[model samples]
Target: MTILLWILIAVCFIASFVGLVYPIIPSAPLLIVGFLIYGFGFGFTELTISFWVIQSVFIILLFTLDYLVSSYTVDRRGGSRAAKIATTVGLIAGPFIIPGVGLLIFPFVFAILTEKIISKKTWNESMSIGIGTVLGILSSALLKGIAMLLMIVVFILYIV
Candidate 1:
């Protein structure tokens, strides 16, 4: 591959690593981009279209599975539909107002508000659910990060 191609792959790799920590950045997809560079642009040419297709299906499955796993954890931990909606709003709004810390606080505020409204829970219970939801999301993200890191290692092993 050309220098430019390799440069682009390098950029994707770095971005994927950033995604590992940054909640907003999508790490797994970025890793997939790097894999695509190797598989489609060069390295896997002799491996056949069927090979690439099968590999692609596997990659997409990983992405979907990670998503489901995280959301499932949040839902299983008593996160209600309203709580989820509010948490999403908080997550989006938090960053604009508070930046780094907002990432943790937004979902918390949303969960509390949602719990208060729908569940008619006391302040203490609302707060508990809020904290629990935040913890769930954080844990899910951590697990997903681990999975993404493993995918990155695989890509590096195969491509590099």
Candidate 2:
């Protein structure tokens, strides 16, 4: 029983990391679920109030990063609302289409097309916005990944 619980917890953590690349997955919730499993399995005596407070902060950060990072970068690059929407569509559809590289390529292509066609931007400007979209995605992923790692570490510290 103990081993099974450990495996379940590990799966949740692994799935949360996978969510970094596949934005469709709810990364923060999965981590929280993992912690809950630990609590339910072994009791929450070890998970103190400080642990919950810290985890809550990280959860908020994760949600903020998910909402703001990509759009913020696109907006900073002068991408229009259409471009931002297109970029989001590309990010969600990319992995399903190209398997691995689609995530980057689709967003770049979508943003550029939206800027050049819908926004009436010049070629160079469109490309710049495209680049910004990709950068934003990367930035969001990196920050979220770090935050999730910290969450896991905190969980371990509390439990161990």
Candidate 3:
């Protein structure tokens, strides 16, 4: 049973990493969930209060930054709600469709075209949103990466 749970946790961690590329799955949240379950599911014998508090804060900050920074980036670049949704869908599809550069290139081109067609924006403004979507992805990833790093360091210091 312990071995099974450990395997499950590791699988969840892998899923979380994959989720980073596919927006609908929320990789960071899943990662934190795995950590939380690992910490609590076995009865919390090894967790210090400070460690829990630190992890809780890191998880909170991770999601918070991911959402705020990404959405704000889109909004700043003139992307509407529809643009975000379309970009997410495109991101998922692009990798399977074209592979490699398709992941980045497809989202950008799709976003630009969608904005131009749906929102009826000029080519220039539509292009701006494309750049913004990239910025949003980068910013959100950066913040999440930092939070995860902090959690890893804390976990090592406090538990392992």
The candidate that achieves the highest TM-score relative to the unseen native structure: 2
Question: Candidate 3 residues 16-96, lDDT tens each?
Answer: 666666555677666667666777667566677877787778778877897798789889887988888887777778767
Residue 65 C-alpha lDDT in model 1: 64
lDDT, residue 141, candidate 2: 92
TM-score for each model: 0.73, 0.96, 0.76
Model 1 has an lDDT value of: 0.69
Residue 36 in candidate 2 has what lDDT?
A: 95
Clashing pairs in 2: none
What candidate 1 gets wrong by more than 4 Å, as runs, is 1-3, 20-24, 45-77
Candidates' lDDT values, in order? 0.69, 0.93, 0.76
lDDT of 1 by residue, 33-106 (tens): 87778666776754466545555665676567655754675566566778877877776677668877787788
Candidate 1 vs candidate 3, lDDT winner: 3
- Ranked candidates, highest TM-score first: 2, 3, 1
Q: Which model is ahead, 2 or 3, in terms of lDDT?
A: 2
Please count the clashing residue pairs in each candidate, in the order shown: 0, 0, 0
- Tell me how candidate 2 scores on lDDT: 0.93
For model 2 the local lDDT of residue 150 reads: 98
